[model samples]
Structures are given as C-alpha cells and as structure tokens.
Target: MAFFKSRDEKKSEEIYKIIMDTLKNRGNQVYDLKVEFQEGVVTLSGVCDSEATRKKAILCAELAEGVKKVNSDPLLLSEAAAQEQAAAVPPAAPVSPNPPIQTAPPAAPSVQTAPAAPVSESPLETGFPSAEAEAAELKPSPEPQPSPQAPETAARSAQPSEPVQPQAEMQTYTIKSGDTLSKIAKQFYGQANKYMVIFEANRDVIKDPDRIYPGQTIRIPPLP
Candidate 1:
C-alpha cells in the first residue's frame, strides 16, 4: 500500500502556524493557546486577559481561508480582568435642566354672581324620575359578537409548505493493502491534489494521511 500519512500532519502544522500568525497579527498573545484541527473546524482553547481577546482569536480563525468553523468553548476570560474592565469605563454625563417657560400677565378680576336654584325636570339630574328608572334607561346595550375567523384559517391554509431537502451523503472506505489518499481522491474526485479534503475530514481517526493501514475506515466527503 502506498502510505503517505505526513499529508495530514503537515496540514495540521500549517493550520496551526496560520492560526498563531493570525492571532499575533491581531494583537492576541498565543503563549497559552492550544489549537486543534478536525473536519475543517478549528478549536481554540486558552485563557485570555479579556473576552475581547478571546473573540479576536475566534475572528482570526474565521478569517483564515480554509477554516469552516471556529470552536471557542474552551476559551475563557479571567474573572478579575472582567471586573477590572467593568470598573475602568467612565460613567455617562448628567442631563442638563430645561429653561423656565415664559408666561403672559394675569387678567383683571370680575364680580361674582349668586348660584341659581336646581330645576326638578333637568335632563341630567331628575328628568328620568326614579333612580331605578334612570339606571335602566342608561344601561348599555349588549356588545356585537365577533365574526368567525375563516379568513385567518384560509390565509394559513394558503401558505405553501417548504420542501424537505436531503442532506449530502458521505462516503466511507476501508483501507486496502496498497492505497494512498491521492489514489483515493483520484478514484473518487478525479484529482489527486484534492487528497487534503479527505485528510481534513478524517483527521479525527487518521493521524497521518500517508500511514493508514489496511482495513482502517476513512471518510470520503462529496466532491466540491
């Protein structure tokens, strides 16, 4: 079997270098950082001075051309650093008071007149006669019943159901006595240089692309 496992190892090394370079270029310290690569995903694990640094690391990984995803679940910010960040920000300025409103001068006063006597037949007070009679007349009528919601039901029924699309099928192969990633890629995707795709996908199980032995299962992603 043509064995060449260094393809995966070399790829991992290159990805690690790129991640480190990106972190450095973005002003992140990588002394405590650990980078892992698998199936097109980059995992960043480390302690950062602040959440912003952690986010910057993830952003740098995302900006890398071949990275499909960045996992920062293992990244953390120091509690003291978080508290210090909160304490360092200055408070907002106070609001200014509004100017006083100007007003017109007071008008001259007039003489007051005596109150008039109440009329027994006034509409508001006594026209309806007894209190019960007035209350009966003033009682509000029953509210109208709401219309049936057929339009809403019809609108819901008119909505089209989304079609279900099948997920892309992944292929797997058991290594033969004499097989290389390049041969497998050529066999599956009509290109040997594209072996990196297979190596990346199977990095979890295949430590070295050139060293896989017979009967070892390997994933073969669909041709891009």
Candidate 2:
C-alpha cells in the first residue's frame, strides 16, 4: 500500500522547495545542503563556499513564506574555503630573535683614601682635667617641667547622636525584544509577582506595566 503525505508534511516540503529555489536563484553554492522544517522553524546544515554565502543562504531561508525562525548554527565554511580566506589576509611581520646588546662605558677609576693620623693620649690619663669636665663643673642642669592636660567641654559631651539611614539604590535596564516587566522582575528580584516594583519605579518612562517596547530604558528599583 502507498502512503500519503500529511498536510503538515506537504507544507514543510513546499517551504523547503521555496528555500532551495531562493538559494539557487541567488547563486549561493552550498555543498551538502540540508533543510529541516518543523513548526514554522527551518534549520540549515551543510558546508558553504564562504561566510557571505552562508549568511545569504540563511537570509533566503528566513525570507521564505511560513518560516518563523532559521537556525544556521550548523552551516559552516569548508576547510578549503577557510584556507583560501586565510591566505587572502597578509601575515604579520616576523619579530627579531635577538636584539642588539647595549654596552656601558667604563666607570671612572676609584680615588685612593689617605690614611688617618694617630689620636693623642687622653688628658685624664695624663692627670690634666678635660675642657668638657671643667665646663660641666661651672654650670648645673635645670629641672624638667611636665605638660598640662586639655580640658573637655560639658556641653559637647552631653549631645545625642543621630542614626544614619541608607539611600535606596536603583538600576537601569534597556528593554530588549520579547522582554516583559514580569520577566525583568524575575531576572532581578527572582520573583515574577514583584513586577509592580519595577513598574512603580519607571513611572516616567513606562506608563503601563504590560506595554513595553524594545530600546526603551526603564528603571529597576531594589526590593525592600
């Protein structure tokens, strides 16, 4: 018995044909090109001649009717193609293995030090009084005085100290495609129900919590 193709299968086949025809018309050479279609998503796998060709193939697949998304991660350039691209770029200049050595000039000759003369014998040993001893005998040392302590003010010590309150910290996040207030709240506060916190903080920019567009900057307030 012969089997018939289902409605979904036929639709997938049509999408695949459309993508293949588009790629062919664009003159993109993709070796071993394979197209997998499911639930409006197309996945491409194969070797391309170059990165530009691969991108073109993916763009063609995406532009096809009934194609919601295209996965081109499996599409890559062949080894030969990669080598050709590498050859097109010039190689960097080679660095020298050994640099030139800089020699310093000879240092000036060291000067010779003259020998010190012999010291004479002390006056105390020769039974004559020294000048320092005679001076000390003429004048006596004065007594040392103590430093005074600073007085503390009674009015300054009786004042009470006030407590310091911390300021609230906020962060700004640019809205990306498919981002919602609840999703942002879940990312920052780890709870989807805390989306109101963000909505209240971004009242100037975000008038409605459910309505947000890409590229709009919103403030994210810290949770209490």
- At residue 162, give the lDDT of candidate 2: 43
Candidate 1 overall lDDT versus native: 0.77
Show model 2 residue runs off by greater than 4 Å. 87-224
What is the TM-score of each predicted model, taking all chains together? 0.32, 0.36
Candidate 1's C-alpha runs over 4 A off are 1-9, 85-224
- Which tens-of-lDDT digit does each residue in 10-57 have in candidate 1? 556676677677667878664467777677788878778776677777
What tens digits encode model 2's per-residue C-alpha lDDT throughout 90-168? Answer: 9999987897788998998999999898898875565777899899888978878766444455555665754333226
lDDT of 2: 0.81
Candidate 1, after superposition: displacement of residue 16 in Å? 2.7
